[model samples]
Target: MNDTNIKWDKIFYGRAWIANIIDIIQTKDILQSFYFKRYLLRAMMAGFIISIITVFVLMVKTTFSLDWGPGLVNMIGAITFSFALVLILFTNSELLTSNFMYFTVGLYYKLIKPYRVLNIFMLCFIGNIIGACVLFGLMRLSDVLTPDMVTMLDQTIETKIHTYTFQNILVRAIFANFFINITLVIAMQIDDVVAKMFVMMFGVTIFAFMGYEHVVYNSCLFVAGLFYEVDHLALWPALKNIVASFIGNYIGGGLIIGLFYAYLNDHGQFKTHRNK
Candidate 1:
């Protein structure tokens, strides 16, 4: 942790966390849910926008690359996506991965209510769909994707998610989601660019490499995939992906990391748990 942020913050860390927990809990109320919903909606919209942009960027990278080595290609893909992280962390945007720490820490300190953590999840998911659905509509109307490219993206997404069975999906998501959240926390806590860049790079790279499911990413991809005339990716497959991914995302994010953070802060000290 940065020493400069400690002097005053150390005394308030406990209080700050508790406040966060409270905010989370308050968000759960039927009347107060709107606050959390708006945040999630905005986050989902941002995520959708980012995903569309990433696809375009990837199109350029893949089309332009000259038979690059797998190592180089992997690095490019990882680093390219890190752009989203920089935006979210710097902009303080909500992302499912980032939520792992945000709410958990709050629950730990009793700053925010614990139940509110999951509230954001549902809202964000719904909001993300709203945004993605719009993007999908635009893509379908646009002549941008040749029928072939549409098929390609869908197949890729399907292949990525289908690698895991429902049970394995949940299990893989747990660890992958945990690391993803921790990655954001680490990035936020760091100041240097090069270091933060690697944290961003390696963190996303691990998730992509592991083929863990990310509902937000897939949501947009699925929409675009549908627009692009992806074959064999019908309603059933789409529903399955959405439903399974939703459960997995929640389990990985809310149940595992969020609760774990709550446990740590609520019970003991809020120290680093570097799996070293």
Candidate 2:
């Protein structure tokens, strides 16, 4: 680890994480050239990569379901899902869920314009959708999924989009991203790779096992379900789920965590005993 990592490892306890989060938010605001088109392209590429990886992991989860018990099965799925975010973070890629925190923090700090942040979000969202559609199409054409796997995916589709009411979907999504982004922020505050991975896995596993909705991951899964002609997985219903998840994720990550933390940290309300 470097000096910054060493310093953080020594002092990253309690509310000290707030200082670290603020420093990271400020660093992203200062270093990222968000106004440039190249940066937009980079964001798109990052979202694209994340979508592809997400689909692969979901496929693994659905395909191997018969071999493991329900709890272990979900655990395996969550672990693989957590790996996708880990790769995104370590590679410096943009994920919309995580970016929600960044954009919110930047806006609160007056370091980024609202319009610019929205543009970043739109670009990344579109990119992720496009990537997901491509992967689904490819998987369908290649006959990659077995009939049993397709059935399993269809059941998941029913569970995610069809069974839940709009309100139910929105609420679950809120809690899902709430825990996810919290994990993200905590992991970002830490320096050790092992600790970071462990925390991320635990947080992601909690949400995944709870069957919470996430916009990007669901985009791919629903599209793949649609492509496979899964029952009740229509375009309109899937779209509704996606939109509700997006809103809930924004609330959970952007407002709940980002705005809340920024407010407390800015007003010097984060000085717990550990910091002193």
Candidate 3:
């Protein structure tokens, strides 16, 4: 194999770049930053709203468009998600799934001593849940779409979930996290905002096309599923999807690819916090 096509872990974390990420996350780890964290908390709510809008558009194309192709609809949905990430990342908003990726680079590299990868997931999960609830409130208050369309949306979520198994969900979760988080980190590597947006959109497009699980995105979907009054039987699928999503997300950010790379790099190359 050529030098250009090396293992991703080597390129991403081998230089101890994970420490840089730790330094950034560290600045925000304070009592004073709680106010700032609140904004991020609300941003999670905003992310749910935006992500559902993506799902809604996907629904419209699937149900109404004469030329509706699953491929096209999925692509458009991905675009929406891509833009949403750009919004969250550039605007400095808090998104649980993506941040898991960011912080894990630190933990894996030993840059962050106390924060386990699970801690990132737990914080992000709670934050994401709050955001989903905010979106539900919006759906309740506004006459956004027809009742029938709302019903369709509900079924869309329900059916998707009910079909999968625990093991299947776990595998899917791994892919979802691996692909989406990689895209997110790649987007961060870009310096320009516009370029970052394009990268993010592409990431969303790819992930959506592949039908990957993401917990935060699912949080929005869950809210919609509930709002649409999807059947209780459907809840099992959604739950399964989410549980799988959590695992997949962890694999994507913490262990499968980058984090392990970061971990190996720390061991082989640079001085960690203790040495400094």
Candidate 4:
């Protein structure tokens, strides 16, 4: 195929990821225009859903780890965890990590302003924290978090906070969101619901099994850690990890995938067609 034919093929052959990006930008634009309270509430709902999934997946992992061994347990946990994103996307929930890509693409296309991007990030993050806290409180009131479960959570928090260097945490966070946004990109292009769910699950499984850092997931975990006696969890260390992970996730999802693809598809023949 000649250059023009190749470009047309990309557009017609289900390879036009930029089309999905445009759709995301338009959706976000509508959401951003909502009243502040309503917008934040929507974000909080997303956060709550994410926290619910996190708790479910962690509990399953903790329970299974005793009998299944680490490898099998990790796989099971990762697979279970993948449902988090599936739920978020299908339910029209706002997750900060995925929004990193969406808004980045918006910025690249000049569909969103930098200030607005920052505003959305702040609102989404605060909402996520609020939701996590609410769930943590509920879990504490309930009898679900056993001593063994608390111990497992503490160990995981310890490793994230103290065992890894700053750079290590940052790098892991990058890869974690890279996988996450990549999943979102691919899932958006797919028309089949089952196929989309599988894509999301598979992409998330890689990051979860690898024990990569994700800021929102870490938020749920850190909040839960507060409920139990922690061996190595400290306020400063946790905050540091959160900060590093946030920066890394932005780099991975926003800069790497979002901006890179925006640039790739917004040029030459693709650009011409998009303009037309």
**Per-residue lDDT of model 3, residues 180-261, tens digit only:** 6777667656778788777777776777667777777776777766665666435556777777777777777657766655
Off-target runs (Cα >4 Å) in candidate 4 are: 1-16, 268-276
Candidate-wise lDDT, in order: 0.60, 0.72, 0.64, 0.82
Please provide, for model 4 over 1-276, each residue's C-alpha lDDT reduced to its tens digit, 9 standing for 90 to 100.
Answer: 466556543563233566666777677767767767666776777778877787787789888877888999888988988888888888777789999998887787677678988988988899888888888888888988777777778889989998988999999999999999888878877899999999999999999999999999998888888766567779999998999999999999999998887776654534443443
Cα lDDT tens digits, model 2, 1-276, are 444334333443434665565665555554345445554444555555655665665577776777778778777777777777677677765577888986787677666578877877777677666666766677777766777677777878888878888788888888888988889878867789999988987888788778888888888777677677777688778889989999999998999988886665554344342253
Task: Give per-residue lDDT, candidate 3, residue 46.
Answer: 52
Better model by TM-score: candidate 3 vs candidate 4: 4
Stretches off by above 4 angstroms in model 3 are: 1-16, 31-43, 49-52, 55-64, 113-117, 232-236, 267-269
RMSD list, candidates in order: 6.7, 6.5, 4.4, 2.7
Best by lDDT: 4
By TM-score, highest first, what's the ranking?
4, 3, 2, 1
Q: How does each model score on TM-score?
A: 0.72, 0.80, 0.81, 0.91
Across 181-263, the per-residue lDDT of candidate 1 in tens digits comes to 66754565567988987787677767765657766676777766665656546676666766676677666766576666456
Error at 219, model 1, angstroms: 1.7
Ranking of all predicted structures according to lDDT, beginning with the best and ending with the worst: 4, 2, 3, 1
Best by TM-score: 4
